[model samples]
Target: MAETLTAASSHGEHAHGEMSFWSKYVFSTDHKVVGLQYMFTGIFMGLIGGFMAYAFRMQLAFPGVEVPGYGLVSPVDYNALVTNHGTIMIFWVAMPVLVAAFGNYLIPLMVGADDMVFPRLNRLSYQVFLLSAIVLICSFFVEGGGFGGAWTAYPPLSAQSQYNLTPLGSSLWLVAVGLEFVAFLIGGINFITTAMNSRAPGMKAYDIPMIVWMIVVASIMFMASVGPLLAGAVMLFMDQNIGTAFFDPDRGGDPILWQHLFWFFGHPEVYVVLLPATGLVADIITVFSRKKLFAYRTVLYTVFATGVLSFTVWAHHQFVAGIDPRMAHVFTVTTLLISIPIAEMMFVYIATLYGGSITLTTPMLWALAFIAEFLIGGVTGVFLGASGADIYFHDTYFVLAHFHYTFFPIAIIGFYAGISFWFPKMFGKMMNETLGKIHFWGTVIPFNLIFIPLFVLGASGQHRRIYDFSHFPNLSAPWQQDLRILATSALLVMLAFQSVFLVNFVWSLWKGRKAGKNPWKSNTLEWTAESPPPHGNWSELPTVYRGPYEYGVPGRDSDYWPQNEPN
Candidate 1:
């Protein structure tokens, strides 16, 4: 499997310095340590995002009643929760886990680098990300009880925070997110440079693993798109602090500019997270099915195509924001085109499964789920991409369902799938397979319960971000009743469902079965090393003779040929 040692174990890159626990572990620049930092931080953020959603879901399903977990919901607090929920889910939960954790861990090892091109820069990026998380967490206690206008922080509503609720923590909310984006921007730079120039002998640009391809393209996406949001964040800071009027209408600033900037990074940010999962799916799909990825060039081209198209589709989110009718049409056309490449990719996956031996491990289960979940999300997205349908669907719970379907499967479920599949390689042990199956079923049943009804709500015209909806009873139909019950029931089940996963994840750390390296007969470079891999990944650097996906090749010793093997 792995014949080549990474730079960490290479002749010149070894470290022998004595170190204290704090310096060696906490502040270390080792990509593995940094990766741990990202995982823990992302889990922490996930808890926050999860709870925030729980709180708001309570408000929506049982409006006007004091909920058990939350006390009598104040109107301002409800809005604040919604705002924080969106912010936390998008920035903290998805990006940190996807970009920071996986990127830090895999990029160096897979590319045969000892560490990132800028190791110290990697450490500093995580530090800043930590600080950003802290600052955002602290915003909850701000005098007015955090920003209440919603996560997008639209102007008029978000700009005059004092007017609607009180500037409260509204001003600081921008700072928290602004800092977070900076963290990713720095992280992206490190990823791009490391992959470009740092490969072992015989590893060409195309020879790199699919996961690395994902990291490269995603980093490029992050670099190109995040600037506008950052500029918007700075303007928002000025509008709130220096009274710069960038978003203040009275002072001749347009609120819509803030949205334009936001969805700009915002939409591409979805792919920034999705591409990695797609890469993981490609890897997992081929490995478990005992076949190569169906069309390697097609996968690469589609990924490249999607990254470029992600930028142009940002305005689809802005369709209902009172933008020009012509702009909506342009966005509609572009958004639809982006889906073509994705549909092509989806076809590749479905086609690859045609004649392969499919295994159903936890990782495989999650990968299959990723396909199902992402497809649902992708299909729903079509309605929202068209200008006519979007005008009706935008700002409604329908939009909420649409993205959750995509992001949950793509980002949350996608990451979960990767982590579970890689857990053996990551932690050096096999998880409880039976328990894992139970966890998967728990996740699947409740997830569909939670998001599917939101589509029904969208059809009925229930707008998102509404704190109190008792006034809307007059417009209700029988369908809304069924949906409200369904969504509420699903939310409860979903929360309870996480416990199964948590228990399996925690218990497996100490009690699970021991696994040999390459338990899945995977062909990628990572499997050539020891289970849980040493500080330096390989004993010696292995020369590459073929691409990473050499499954079912005739005359091989086994079902797959390792990437580092000689022909």
Candidate 2:
């Protein structure tokens, strides 16, 4: 191991070096530190999003009733909460933690490169993201509280200052989101370049870990898809400030154009967030199953297929938005067709588990739960994807429940699996497994408790985005009221459970048991480096000998074979 470290460091200017605190942490170009920075910031923003959800949930559960910590939420406040919560959770929280953080940290290490192809750009990415986040937070303090035009920031309402109500905050929200896109563009380019050019010797395209491949594919998809929306956002910004009529119907501009642009990016945007998660879950499933991943190439091909199909299906979101009726059929077919590749991937995962020596590790638990939860999400999506069913379900709590099912598994559960699986490698210590399992069950159960009832609410004809339900007798029925309270209580339970995870994460960072290299005995190149890999991951570049998953080989003395081992 020491020889391996020495050999790795002996190449080029890749030796582990010391630095001042500010240089090492504050403005460091080290991908690992930058990754952690992204993760912690994302976690903080997720909490804020959660609080926003809690406030709105309270309003839903007990209409007009003031909560203890926070006062009664006004309709304006509720709208702002809805808009900002969706924005923050998806962009600030999920994207940063899952994509930016993990992509920076893992791509080079798994591919056997010392650092990102553009290290300084990597640092710049985080800095710009931090700036965007700060700007968004500042938006909340502006004259009208915060942007209340919903997360989609749809036009007509979002375009015109008079209709939008929160002009200053909405303008800032556009700026913040646009800046976020720019930061990601920078980071996405880095991911593509590094993955394409930075692999160690013998690491071919097929040999790349599924997670790395997914990240690369997602970056490409994001780059390709985000352009129109970025243009739309800029146009919307113009509409907000300069009286441009880009999306304002009254000014002879078509509001539908913004819908086209936003959903063009929006639908694929879900896949952009999802692919990395699926990849992370893929890696974790194989690691704990102690088996080679079943159908690796097939899975990789599905990722490519999914990325391509994602662009075509974005119109599904515009189904109920008064697009050409004829076009709705085209989109409905595309939407349903997109599910086939995804279903294939899911089947492959289940097949991977068959006959494998599955270890019920905390990461494995999260991965399994992700599969189950995501299945529900996927199945429910069919209702929304079909133009006919969407008419009935549109703007209902069903839509909200469906997305949460999808995103929670991808963003929340998948992130937990990655964190639990990689905590040892990242921090050189083992997280408390007892607490981790507790957190997992605590989260999974309460999460379902919260969202499952929402499906019922949606079916009960309770429309979404309603500030107060007291006036609608059908929606305000006693039973519906009870269900809402149940969901809110479940949310509180989930929050309490999250505290356990927070404590575990911080406590484990400093005091947990030491983790030696390759603690999980996995085959990836990341484990070839030291736990908490040093600056410039390898002292000398290491070569990959085989694919990422080589577990449970027949006739081998050990159940797992590291990718770098001599054949």
Candidate 3:
């Protein structure tokens, strides 16, 4: 095995040494580079989304005032900012960072493969994603100033350029979204195929790392649910430009059909991003807490249950959309039932941490925060899930608060956790832990402060879609306006503290301590490879002998056991 690895390493070095910069970084087929591309691009888009949030929140808090960085926030501008903010964060930021980037980077290394089964397809996926982002950005500069019908793009508003007032922007928005889905569809296939076919010899399905399993399941969920949305996007695009009224009720079409199509994928889309974040948390907590994952098979089963139940709950979103009471009752049951499996997964994570040697490292902090914060999201969701409560809460700040509670943990905190955990391996250097903890406290505290006020405002009957609360006498009261100001103020603090993270990330890349392989003393196969693994992940591929989480085996000298290590 050593001899084989030595020869392979020598060959990889020669080949990598001969490649030019463009071929190496730009057009490279290396999964790590492709993953880095996705990560950086996602981060860039996150900034745009954040800025949009700042602009709109400013409009809400201090109506008709010009935002500091962004100029005046007209109603049209407010709509555009809100619509694109949601769209960019979900499609561009969350999917890419949580699924594509980490999946591409971790799968091959953890599974003991040198590269993905179809390398060219992987490269094409990212290229398509980048192009889609560019198209979405360009829509902002077009004649109509971006789509204002909201990210859901409901018809009448989304289908008719007359209602939306963005003939060009709405179509471009649809096109960009369609292109983004295509990219993920391609990437999802690669993730599933590679994990299935490319694992090192003797690595059984049960032996796979939890993060890899979560990514694979997430990809499957995405592929399964995305088909309907893709078809809908095309139809909606045609409706906008080519005179099709697929979603136009006035033109002999059912607008509700678009809702069905959108939410069909939309609710599952929540779990799609969610499962990957859960997976990241699972791996991080287990490693940092120094314990094997509690009830590994059970966790997998619950994930499967969550994915299946995710489909049934989509209709719950339409309860207030004029769906039947009978139908709403059925969906309400399913929505409440879906919580059981997710709750079980949370308990399982807590069980794993119960008696373990807990380390409050940066990554560990983010992982723990994911649980605490997401609990608030899940508990609050029960209200919105019920038909009776939803009628009042729907489109209110309550729903918005519930959404941020869920997604902030899933996307933002998840990204920070995974990146902090994998920074050493990805960049061959250790991050500054002091700066990391500072960023974590700074970010998480403000996050809660921002959303909790929204929750209160929402319960006070403040609607989410309002351009200015001053227009509504009841919502514009002193107390309610104060909540808006508080939430907006918290958002500013959160955004400002992000610079600490930026400095830490950039500085640590070149100037921090050099990290050797297995900095975390992890047992996963990825940790067995070099820090910032080379073109070929390992000179000699690993052969697995055990499951990933094997901490504190009674008779072992070292506390953890690597999957590739043979007795």
User: Local distance difference test, per candidate?
Assistant: 0.83, 0.91, 0.93
Clashes found in each candidate (C-alpha, N, C closer than 3 A) = 9, 4, 0
Clashing pairs in 2: 8-539, 8-540, 9-539, 9-540
Model 3 CA lDDT for position 473: 96
lDDT of 2 by residue, 1-567 (tens): 434533344334423467889989889888889899999999999999999999989998888999757798998898999999999999998899889989989998999888888888988999999999999999999998899999999888887767768989999999999999998999999999999998888889999999999999999999999999999999999988898898867779988899899999999999999999999999999989998889999999899999999999877778788888899999999999999999999999999999999999999999999999999999999999999999989989999999999999988998899999999999999999999999999999999999999999998788997888998877888889899999999999998899999999999998999999989999999998999998888767788889998899999999898888889
Off by over 4 Å in 1: 1-14, 163-166, 475-479
For 381-491, candidate 3 gives per-residue lDDT tens digits of 999999999999999999999999999999999999999999999999999999999999999999999999999999988888899888789888898888889999999
Least well predicted 10-residue stretch by lDDT in candidate 2:
5-14
Question: Residues 300-344, candidate 1, lDDT per residue (tens digit)?
Answer: 999999998998888887777788988888999999999999989
Q: Rank the candidates by lDDT, best first.
A: 3, 2, 1
Return the TM-score for candidate 1, rounded to 2 decimals: 0.96
Kindly state the number of residue pairs that clash in model 3: 0
Cα misplacement distance, residue 109 of candidate 2 (Å): 0.5
Say which candidate scores most in lDDT: 3
Q: After superposing candidate 3 on the true structure, give the runs of residues whose Cα lies further than 4 Å from its correct spot.
A: 1-17
Q: Where does candidate 3 clash, by residue pair?
A: none
Give the winner by TM-score: 1 or 2: 2
